[model samples]
Target: MSDLNKLGLAEARDALRKGDVTSVELTESCLKAIDDADALNAFVHKTPEIALERAKAADARIKEGDAPSMCGLPIGIKDLFCTKGVPSQAASKILEGFKPEYESTVSQQLADAGAVMLGKLNMDEFAMGSSNETSVYGNAVSPWRRGNDDAQLTPGGSSGGSASAVAADLCLAATGTDTGGSIRQPAAFVGITGIKPTYGRCSRWGIVAFASSLDQAGPMTKNVRDAAIMLETMCGHDAKDSTSAELAVPNFEAMLTGDIKGKKIGIPKEYRMDGMPAEIEKLWADGAAMLKDAGAEIVDISLPHTKYALPAYYVIAPAEASSNLARYDGVRYGRRAHLAQGDGITEMYEKTRAEGFGHEVQRRVMIGTYVLSAGFYDAYYNRARRVRTLIKKDFEDVFAAGVDAILTPATPSASFGLGEMTEADPVQMYLNDVFTVTVNLAGLPGVSVPAGLDAQGLPLGLQLIGRPWEEGDLLNTAYALENAAGFVAKPGKWW
Candidate 1:
């Protein structure tokens, strides 16, 4: 067998069940790897002690012949997910000392299915930035490199840490949430596979709210099958989230097939925006050609409302974020600063929030509040909602025309330098989500798979979008792409 360091969840679990390995042994290997790779900044909290305990419990269950699908597997939990005693800060200072008393429905589900928790992974503060620099902890350097130079490049965000850790095999797979392009973009940069299931497919009860209407947690892994296994375990209905879909979460693992032989795939013409890099455009065309090579019929399709997606997403996500963040007014459960000598409670709140939140975070709050305010709600927020409906209608129309799925580039380009984006105007940063945000607005399933690489040696990713709740189709197509691309999930140096 390959070194335990490189094994994925299924491989380790199968080895353990057959008595060829022990959970303690696998967990120890991971702990050692994390210990050796401190510069990656992938972990916000490393709980080796608890990880060992959980691994032992998994070994006990296996001994009794009651092993679950995830028995003996270690998975990283994004800091955004609430873990009872773990600091789920969402990489924000306002919640610096905050610890949840309960686990998120998604994390709890994963635990119940027998996946061992490695620790909390890093993210952009409250899951905000496209590059991981918004993190209070610091940027997560990609495990990839262009050549011999070790200049740090972004791992992508707000799930950059999760993608970096999984790609490095610090943990088998990590949970991630996508609001705009958080999960998919990072996975693309790290050369891994990640899925953002149809909105409402995964419950959001204990995942920290960023843009609540757009955020949905999913998985990051080395390959498509692992993504399926993680998704099947964590996705289901939860009464705590009223928006959680009551529809059955399919057995995604059982449904992954390379037999998209007669599938009809749509390539949206609207995605061909001017100024997109030549390499990115070529990657998309190559991806379409691969699908055609695999017996899938590719057709040109128009989602005419695509131009409005980014503008509408910005208005709606910010509007919702403003409302969601109002709960952190320094009184209920987050950090609060002392007031000026003669000031009152209101001033204390103002001081605390001003000191605690980062620049981008503050910007979103202001934009959100502005759009939702009475003076501008109709002009900005409501108009965006109407455009959101149009974006949804475009997808519905295409699906009605017998399109099995839609394919597009995951991001406009490969991972830019970490500081390249952070130094940019905030609107320029928001433009990074241009291709991925519309699917979120429509509440459809989407995924990003490694397609190829740009000349800079950064990996390119292709996204697959499925009709509402059709994650099975999304994973199936990703699997086909993974095989067609012949990509290997290898990190440059970390661990």
Candidate 2:
């Protein structure tokens, strides 16, 4: 009927269940959109054959009258998720031509629920970098433009493809992973909704590990309701992953009553950094005002260890990254360097890594190795771990003091141009995660709700951080924020 791909997840699911439309029709619409939107480089690996096949099966399942809320919905899969028989490269060259014979637990769950996979979307190489610039397939451009300017902006990463595709209406929703704001930052930049559930809520069985402790898979969608529905389908305990919480999955969509009365939302004083954009500051205040008007109490709170989150994250993430990435030394899977006749095993390892990893991935791996090395372990890695503990405790103390949720700006500012940050000082790029890393360290749930637009017309989002194991409550709060903000802006389809 009316452009099937334009419908949100819940809308499409209802339509499919009512016999108003079939999953095949919806999947085909998204497939055509993916072909038309290739200039954005969002879908790195298109699987039209599999998508259509799955769509046909989903239609049958829908006819049987036992389909889930996500059943027969077309969605984009982030390249990081291992889809058995499909390329699961993590947008890195080292994993070139590597296809996992096993499906990632989250994707498998989604598939089991009858969600049709349109294709694997692009992302930052190995989920590194703030922008999508590190993707081997190329930069995934934001659909938004700044006031008649043709210059391209970044749909924040490493979930840029998910953001870009969803904003452009290429898919109903998409899967994304957050290590340090990867999902929320991109969703904020593109004016959509993304939520990183409480750590260990979703199993990390087949998703390539960047930082095992911090990395988590979640849903990015057009609205809070859609996000809630998709998140329910994505989260579950898996015996394959030890970190996965052995807790029962809740009906997150059903929990969205939007009545946030008496919810005490905390405003962290430390998030008001020096030189913060007046627009972002005002947006944060506006979001707090919206929540207050919705009957939630706004209270000022302190997270004294907030200043150390970035430094601690850099140290801890890279240190874990160093260990997790060590398995890719050309012996088991993925790309291998052509060895010279006289070259030894050591030479093969060095050559393979040197040839495979991009500059940013290499830099992090080196930093990770350095921190975990003999002399600096205590000075850097161990100390950073202790700071992480302090950061987690800060959130715990606030929540223990009766705070229901915390509010902050999702990104320091709206999306910037693609090549704005240079390699000379990569720290500038790393600074993008300043507002989000604390949630990861604390293993709590957080959501980004597109609240307003910047002066340049780029989308700006407000974040809600919730208590551990309370994603249902968090999604309810985000639903309130989304309803209050009334943000319906969409990027013009220039691609």
Candidate 3:
């Protein structure tokens, strides 16, 4: 079953169900793969013993003729998600020692469906960086390029580890949070399928918040089918998260329509920005052509406020991140800084904060504090919110004009060398999220699927933005494209 490494979760589950394999055996295979792929650092904490035990329990249930929908499936929970006994640090030194007494609603839901928790995975420190390099544990290397040599490409972040793990076959599927493209960007980097669902679709109750309003948890997997199965389990309402909507969670798995014949897909005119790399431009055109070949009606539409999304997202996300992170004061949990005897209460809080937050985290905190400050609130934060409303309106207007969904490039470029972004200015990094951040701001469902690869052989992803609560259309379109644009580039023999 060595070749089983690249098999989709559904395929493996079928194998397990047909007596072709056992949960214990599959779990052991994944465990050995993790051990063999240590350089990927996909996992912050790997618990083989617990994983195997859960697998055995699932196998026993299968034998007893009473297995849950996700029995025997292995998943990687992003470290930002809390686990009962396992640590969840959000990959920051500040929350380094913190462990939640409770599991996140998403994690608990998955466990109830019988998914085996492989372990907590790594992320950007406090989910701040676009690349995984900002993790306090150091960057989680992309397993595809063989550790840190040769290409040494980034796996994307802060869900880089999740994407890399899923792409490299270290895990069947993984959980990811999108504050500002965390889920989609990394999925693009590692050549995997990831969905950033409708904001309230997946309850955010135990996820470590980056930007409360924008932070959403979703699934990252090798293909759309695996993501559909996991989304079925995680998408639901919970009383704990007051922001959680009371709307009924649709049968996401059952709704993945295979036929896209005659559906209208909008090609947003704003996305074809000037100076965009030619290779990416070709990828977008190719994607549109493929959809046209699949009997889709393509029309050029305008999101007039598209250029304003990045600025608006930066302001709003940091503003919300600052408020959400205030709970990290040394009093309850995580790291604490030493203070001098003369240091007063204010100094204590300040010093501990300075010690706890990393450079990117501090940058966000500063931006957040500034915009929300007494004098700047109206000028910065509120104005950005108003602009966000207009952006959302743009999408609604297009959909009202009979567009099934809007398609665009997931990122400006494919996976770059690991340190290429980190060494650049922070604005450059923020620009990376330019294409994907608006979906989260509008509380809409968005997904990135492998469209094609660049000339360098790195993967390129095309994003589909759906109307609020219309993930079904977005996913169906993705499935159609996945079949048409068949570009699957695996890692080579040499690193």
**Which has the greatest lDDT?**
2
- Model 3: how far is 12 from its true place, Å? 1.2
lDDT (CA) per prediction: 0.88, 0.95, 0.85
lDDT of 1 by residue, 1-495 (tens): 445868877677778989998888888888888878788899889988889999999999999999777877988999999999888899998998888899899999988877889899989999988888988888877778776656787888889999889888888899999999898999988888889998899999999998878999999988898898889988999999998999887888888777789899999999999998999899999999999999999999999999999899988988888888888878878788876689888887788889888988898899999998889999999999999999999999999999998989998877777787655578888888998999889988899999887776778899999888889877888888888988874656733
Number of backbone-clashing residue pairs for each candidate, in the order shown: 0, 0, 0
Q: Mark the regions of model 2 whose C-alpha exceeds 4 Å error after superposition.
A: none
> Would you list the rank order by lDDT, best first?
2, 1, 3
How do all the candidates rank in terms of TM-score, highest first? 2, 1, 3
Per-residue lDDT of candidate 3, residues 1-495 (tens digit): 665656677898788778888888778777777777777878888878789888888898888877756788888899999888788889988887787899999999988877888888888988888889888888887755533347677888889889878887877899999987999999987788999988888899988888888999999988887778788788889999988878887766677777888899999989888889998899889989999999999999999999999999999989998898888788878888899989887887899989888889998989999999999999999999999999989988998999998889999888877888765589988889989988988888899998877776678899888888877778888888888888677665321
lDDT of 2 by residue, 1-495 (tens): 978999999999989988999999999999999999988999999999999999999999989998888888999999999999999999988999998899999999999999999999989999998899999999999999998999999999999999999999999999999999999999999999999999999999999999999999999999999999999888988999999999999999999999999999999999999999999999999999999999999999999999999999999999999999999899999999999999999999999999999999999999999999999999999999999999999999999999999999999999999998878899999999999999999899999999999998999999999999999999999999999999999998888
Model 2 TM-score relative to the real fold: 0.99
Estimate the TM-score of every prediction: 0.98, 0.99, 0.97
